[model samples]
Target chain A: MKYLTYILRNARRNPARTGLTIASIAISMFLMMILTSFFAAMQEANSASRQYNRIIVMNANGFAGVVPIARVRQIAAMDGVVAATPFAWYGGKYQNQRVLFAQFGVDADSVFDTLEEFHLPDDQLAAFKADKAGAVVGPKLAREYGLKIGDAMPLQGDVYPVDLKLNIHGIYESPRNSDQRMVLFHHDYLDDQLRLLGPSSSSGSSATQPSGRAGNAGIVFVRCKDAAATAALCKKVDDEYRSTDNPTRTQTEEAFGQMFSEMMGGMKDMVFWIGCAVVVSLLFVAGNAMAMAMRERTMEIAVLKAIGFGKGLVLTLVLVEAVLVAGLGGALGTLGSKALFDLFDVSPYTGGFLPFFYVPWRVALAGLGVSLFVGFVSGVVPAVMAAGSSVVDGLRKVV
Target chain B: MSAPPSIELRGVEKEYRRDEFVVPVLQGLDLSVADGEYLALMGPSGSGKTTLLNLVAGLDVATRGQVIVHGQDLGRLSEGQITRWRADNVGFIFQTYNLVPVLTAAENVELPLLLTKLSRKRRRENVATALRVVGLEGRERHYPRQLSGGQEQRVAIARAIATDPFLLVADEPTGDLDRGTADEILELLEQLNREFEKTIVMVTHDPLAARRAGRILHLDKGRLVDDVINDSAAAAG
Candidate 1:
């Protein structure tokens, strides 16, 4: 404890240099925490999808193409299937073009059963099942548009020409952040509207016509009776569509979520690489600062050695100083990042993919681990140099 | 019947290498200092006086021969063992008053005691005693820069004797002070020698400072040339 005062005072010898080094470390660690949080959010979405025991079967041509609704019944009757729901993307603007949120057309009767994470009251669930134009909105979407049960919400469609007027049948909540920014309506309503617009309204040549036929759906979501059977069920579904006009591409919910996340220009890998670059840059900055400090304290180190401090003790002192600097920076950076994330909503940055983006505890811990690693790497070279120099020669130095 | 010599250098030789040349600093120098003896080494520039002091203090090793101080051959001990031995047996004073600038007077004095297993209270008591012995009892809180030349040297002296070592080695202890401050420091050294019975080996070029010691030795070109006993100065003391 007595010696700690000396080490701290020595660090303050050049206040400007020490302050700059600490600031650089803090900023780099802040960047590292942000990158780590982004990856964690993506992984969180993937894990949430896995927990639901859901699988997505889309057209092999891609999500733009369609799957037959008849496949939903076949999937539900499959050996490992529990329930199935058909889903289609409705890129709608609420009241104006600026207010954008995820709006999906789903088979409302089986949606709650397939996605057990979405929770609504018993009466509201019955009300949604009974009304033809009823919609279930997420709590966040409901709060954003001042919606309540039985409130009428209108959406202007950009992809399709028909405008949708829906009654808010229920407001559901989920533990997962990604699930709380969406609105789900009956897929039959979308089909009716598209049919009213005629067959020419289908923009893509590959897009299937909404003809109220048994074989017509944008995508099918199947819930497996056992999550471990997801792989086998995916293979079975793919085989069943092999000879059909539009063959299917089937995957577990986790893989489907990962694929969508990757579709955003491989951002998960980019964030990981950016994190690596931040660590490397921090290592260099910290190493240079420690080296310069050791050089300036050469004479003092010799004085300590002469006064009977062994090489091990000297090395420990140097390492302790380095760790102290890095630890302080790590604490500030992590706490600062936490505050920034808590104050701002960064969901727009993720393009509505990760609706709930915040720094997780594990990411904070990893950021601290990186800081300590930087400290260790930076301290090694300078600590060895200081401890290895000849005491006589060191004392002979004027400084 | 008398105690053995406190320091013994038998045929000590030291050499330094400059790229390709082997520059000899001390060659076959034999010297001894008895217990409680106050001795000084006086020489011209580059006469190997400081080198011999370093050898005696166990700060450097002899190229050949044995430097047996307090009956332990320093050359045989590893560098780490030598450092521990120095901490336990030898106290050092430098010409520049090598006090760690960042530490206060008491903190600097407390440095050598840190290596010991002494408790904080005991170390503080020892530091206070050492500072009082050098007559800077109330100035313990002052930094090195806050003290004058004489006071800084006194703090250095306090630090050198903080562990109560058997041997005290000083290299030009008053080289960078005015005459008044220098004489005050020399008087302090004389007082420590007479009162505490410390075995002092100082290296200095100042004749007056040399006269303060019981015996003085002169070195020229890595060899001792004179051994003068200061009986008159001793009588004055």
Candidate 2:
């Protein structure tokens, strides 16, 4: 404890150098924290999709192609399948085209059966079933847009060309916070509105609507009785549609989420590599700073050694100084990132991709671990040099 | 019959190697200092006076022969053990007054005691007594750069003796000071030797500083050629 003050004072010997080193470390650590948090959020989203015994059936051509709604009945009647629901991407905007959220047009009758994680009240479900133009919003989305039950929510569709005016029937809660950012309504209401707009209406433009049918869906979500049987069931469903005119691609919900993440051009791996680069750069920066400090203190180190301080003690003193700087920078970067995320809503920025973008405890702990690693790596060379110096020769050094 | 010598050097040889060249510093030198003896080593440049002091203080190892201090053979002890021995037994004063610039006088004086298991309050008391002994009681809060050359040397001396070691080794203790300040420092060393009964081996080229010592030895070519006793100065003091 007595020596700690001496170490700290020595670190402050060159205030400008120390300050710049700390700032560099802080910036790199902040970048690392953000990257790690982003990767963690992606993993959380993928993991959330894995918890349910569900499979996603999309067009073999990929997510851009529409799946026929008539396939939902065949999928539900397949072996090991409990129920299936057709979910169409509305890509709707609220008030303006910029206010976007995850608004999906789903089969209202089979949604709860397919997605048991969403907890909606029985009365609210009955009201949504009774009203053709009824929508159920997640609690997070409701709080974000200041929505309440019984309010009419108007959405401007970007992809479908139909403007929707639906009543907010209920706000559902889920175990995962990311799951509570969705707005789901009946696909039947969308098809009925499109048919009323006539084939010549702008709302019924051929570019916006799927050809050959008014009831086509973007994808079908199939629920299975056993999660372990998902791979075989997916194969069976894909095989059933393989001989048809429009083949289907069937996969587990987790795989579907993974494919979406991959469609973003390997963003998760890019983030991981960026995190690695930041850590390496930080190591070099901190190491150079410590080496410079050691060079300046050569005589002082010899003085300490001549005064009977052990090599281990001198080494520890230097290492403690390095760790103090790194730990302070790490704490600032990580806690600062948390505060920044909490102050702003980033879900809208992600375009509803990452519903939960906050830093998790694991990512924060990993950031701190990286900081400690940087400190250790930075201090090792200088600490060894200080400890291994010859006292007689060191005393002869003028500076 | 008397107590064993405070420090003993037997045929100690020291050599420095630069690449393939082995440059000899001290060759087959033998010397001893009795307890409470004030000894001075005088020589020209490169006479191996500082080298001998370093060997006695356990800062450097002898190339051959034994450096036994306070009844323990330093050459036989490992590097770590010698370091521990030096902490417990030897104090050093440098000509440059190598006080850690970042620390205050009190902190500098308190540095050696940090190696001990002493409490903070006990260490503070020791630093206070050391500073007072050097007549810098109120200057304890001043940094080395803020102090005069004489004052910085006094703080360095205080740091050397703060741990109450068995022997004090000084290398050109007043070489960097003016005549007046050098005399003051020599007087302080005299007081420490007389009052505290500290065995001191000092190296210097200053003849006046050598006169203050009880005995002086002159070295030439790594071997002692002359030994003189200052009887008149001892009687006068």
Which stretches in model 2 have alpha-carbon errors above 4 Å? A70-84, A109-127, A138-151, A174-181, A197-213, A222-243, A351-353, B19-21, B136-149, B178-184
Worst 10 residues of 1 chain A by lDDT: A206-215
Off by over 4 Å in 1: A1-3, A77-79, A98-100, A123-131, A141-152, A200-216, A261-273, A349-353, B138-140
Interface RMSD of each: 2.2, 2.2
Enumerate the candidates' DockQ scores in order.
Answer: 0.59, 0.56
Write one digit per residue (lDDT tens) for candidate 1, span A101-144. Answer: 78888888898898887788899999998987999998876776
Query: What shift in Å separates residue B237 of candidate 1 from its native position after superposition?
Result: 4.6
Worst 10 contiguous positions by lDDT, candidate 2 chain B: B228-237
lDDT of 2 by residue, B1-237 (tens): 878888899999999999999989899888888888889999987888888888989999999999999889999998899899889988889899999998999999999999999999999999999999999989989999999999999999999999998799998899999999999999999998989999999999999999989989998888888888879557755
- TM-score of candidate 2 on Cα atoms, chains taken together: 0.89
Local accuracy of candidate 2 as per-residue lDDT tens digits, A125-225: 99988888999998878988899989999998676667889999999877654667788999888877666766555435443453323567888999998
The clash numbers for all candidates, in the given order, read 0, 0
